[model samples]
Target: MKYVTRTCYLGQISILSVAITLTCVSPNVVSAATPTLGCDDSMKTAFKPDGNTTVLLVKKVKKDDPYPSPSKEQQIFPNRPARFAADLCWVKLLVGPGVPGPTGAPSTSRGIGIEVWLPEKNAWNHRVHALGGGGWANGYEETVVGRMSVGNGNLPAPRIAAEEGAVTATTDSGQQYAGASFAMNPDGTVNVAGWRDWSYRSLYEQAVKTKALATAYYGSPPNYSYFEGGSGGGRQALHVAQNLPEQYDGIVSIRAGASTTSDIAQLYPELLVLRDLGGKAPSREQLEAVSAAAVAACDIVAGQHLGFILDIRRCRYDPTKDAAVLCRSDGGTNGTPTCMTSAQALVMNKVWYGLTIDGSVPDPALDNGWDAPVTGVRIWYGYPRGGYIRSLQGDLTWPEMKSGGPDIIALALGNPKIGTPDFKNATANGEDGWKTLTYAELAAAYQSFRAMQSETGGDPDYNSDLTRLKISGAKLLQVNGLHDPSAWVQGLTEYYDRVMAKMGGPASVQAYYKMFVVPGMSHGYFSGAANPNANPPVPADGQLYRALVDWVEKGVSPDSMVFTSPAPGSESSVYKIYPHPHGPQMSLPACAYPTVATYFSGDIFKAQSYKCR
Candidate 1:
């Protein structure tokens, strides 16, 4: 048999081939032999929910075949897997008239792109895995068809659900993977529907149709359904757990940027501090020195000796205490490379002390209440000694450094001075678009965007309806990296506490949901000491998806899991390696909340040397 490739108008050739033949049944039509049908037809099934929805294509993908995007311009990452096999279904959803099209122009169809991948009959595992995306962007089809199913972070062969023999799906949420292009139309009007799709609707709609497609393909419903993602994907998982508890059996969020409110509160304060210390920002070496000194001072402060502080809450190591070593005697310039300038010291101290304007603390007060005598700022990143301070790019202008460059920032700060052109260009190039707005204006804009996200379900309040999830018997596992620079660890800790307070208590929350804190690990994966190229495999340590499956199918919950760090200078390290007192490769058993990993002597590099206390 000869196979030919064809490209769609959007210039995308799905990772799952549209050429492979499939035997499909039309909606409302039934046949037993449909399960054994071949992929010769394109439109084997038609799903039209209303006048607005349309099922564009349905085809079977054969195993061990090459599948790539239609154009090289597509931003799909990593690479295609060695063998791609699945039943591919494509649908175009309508968000009503006046909805912006791909070019940000008006169109009636308001085409919301959605794709689903199902394992071929022989490889079907009777389960479903839905993937997620990062930043303020919608879930991407590139992820669904991309090499890694769980995500690129857990990649390097095996883990992408389809390859593991489960059904998978992703949607553009009425927009492409291009950051926040869909947030605002060219006319500067808010794309409410696009925001809806980005927030919760896109995932909601795709999950619904995915189940029906699964049943239609296999002739029976899946035994289990799950979601796996990191960062923004984690936020989406929380959204599903709250809004659509019935669709999934299990869900896991890795290093989740769960609260937009916190992002708004702390993001600007850090930017402001850096803004004041222009040309005197701390170098990477200085940042590492601060982290090392902090760890050294706090290592045994609260009955813990470790690579990274296991529980930052109990350990209150002050950076200012080591100011003599950190600050230059002259307080001008020409000091030791390990020390901070007076200006740099002031900025660092302010960053540590979270969001404050004119000595007045902001609402939803900083979550660093555990810090005894809480000296300065004590923000999220300030808690853990090596909490990714080096990751902050302060070289950029104040405007560029704000909000870490999310497209949603553009929408929020876009006013008369910094209009659509600036927003669009700022996203493309690292332009200092915020200079156009006054301090008051910028503050107002941030609040506005934060409110919009909250109302639209983007900035989740952590007040998720977990009771509904518990009632439905669904399982949720939230794994947070102690050194996550983007999301505040203290904030997340507080949110978990609120869950316990709102619900019954730790036991009640634990029955349905579990939060695990990874020691020594930074955002995504890896500790400061691990090599970016040689970092340890995340799943090898956490077994996230596998754990979810066990809990959903066998009623088992993850307690203590040993996670390893990638070796120095290895191919697996995807991020930069910072200095830490620990060895090149380290392992630790991350424990559930209220319990910390206590050091017990002997071969500190191995996880078995320590016990979860």
Candidate 2:
């Protein structure tokens, strides 16, 4: 990693010794050149293909091009039909897989899909941006068509950038939808090449491909490139920063989850145990009550009650201390929803502390005794039940019909190279494989899972080679919601700490990267409110995205990110609401880590009342 002197400055020292210090800066400065390609130019012949890469489409779309109305479920972009008023060149490419990934990984020679939308010369902003997909996403066609459906997955970049004359692109990550495991070979082994693409290679491939297409289409490469996404997308953003930092100048990761394999391996077993608890198992409502109680008891641990705790580490309210409120004489429901039964209380505490049994998971390669519990209902108790069942237990009915889930289980169990019969036999006869599995056996299987995940670049390792990112001076913004259950918030905080340690401690990490912790927000978005997805689940202000752009292009680091929700009874402001659609509007500021947002005084519904302490 080489650092170049960006600007020269001379400063005199006031000390007795006369000495001058020289500082080398490398901040991203945008170029002012305009694109030379015209809307009616011959872009088709200009795009030169890479190995196994086929340029599928290169056509100009008028401002009045007919865009179909998005179905109700895909209505995240309400005004997307006419949003891109400028002439646009839509380019689609099919990059053949055999491309080798990060050193030693399998080659992705299969078909990897990519689409780059570029504005005409008049609308061109001399820049490019990439969109990220959500949970186990196999494709990103929805983004190109202007319909982003994940939790706050709808970024302003595609619409705003295109209208502003910038280019944007997305990839299918080699597979087509949520079930990326479909890329497995027919013999029940991983299609290493396809899996390689799914791991992290597709992003790099897509970026390289898009840049080539942009150069051919616009007569020059972009001045700057950016990437943004939430959840799985956030993980991809981290990958770009970690493995391919030179590709993007700025990156935004919202509620980044750990490796998919890691989450599945750890979370699936916890769910199985929770389900096997029989009647003692707590309901989602009961779990939420425990969380509320925890908030009430621990939120004040930092000296002020802000309805929720910004820093959970500062508060250690024990669930056992509230036994009176949980345990009734007969272990029955206490009538009030706030109380729990004795069995419920015990189970809840176990969840709060996560599974600590001897065989819960394989030990980390670089263990610091940070094997903490996956608490609360959101990550475990409140996750999408169908997703768990479908991904793991082979969609088999629970309690009675247990055997036969998916071969992916073999991968999760640490036997990535197992055959279909071996996979079937592993789960065919017992209580969903849990009954016959011993601690030693489970630990071995988990070890295999981790090894394969790392080889495939799927394991969310604590450290990465960030020297390139730091040296290049790319800006990285990572935001995690404290209450997001799908991905353990603690794990992310721990990862950031590890990055700090690996990179050179707090100051070094803070130079080019910063993390913000949002209070009361869920995995990908705010879930406590009704119709959280009615609008992009993130802050309506899009401050994080704007903040990254400012940092990258203007060298302005945002001090605070203010998040806002629609005022109470204004659910109609964005889209339709269902289920429980009533809650007070909220406005809060998520300060950089270590400095938590504290409620001071005045209007609590406004962010001005909160200060980053």
Residue-level error in angstroms, candidate 1, position 243: 0.6
Could you give candidate 1's per-residue lDDT for residues 215-263 as a string of tens digits? 6667666778787767767877877777666778888877777866455
In the range 389-460, model 2's lDDT, one tens digit per residue, is 111222222221122222344545423233233232211311244334443444445455556666566644
CA displacement after TM-score superposition, residue 50 of candidate 2 (Å):
2.2
- Give per-model TM-scores: 0.78, 0.74
Which portions of model 2 show Cα errors greater than 4 Å? 1-45, 64-86, 98-109, 139-161, 265-276, 279-281, 301-305, 318-333, 336-339, 358-408, 414-445, 460-462, 527-538, 569-587, 598-613
Provide the overall lDDT of each model, using Cα atoms, as 2-decimal numbers. Answer: 0.54, 0.54
Task: Give me the candidate number with maximum TM-score.
Answer: 1
Candidate 1 accuracy as TM-score: 0.78
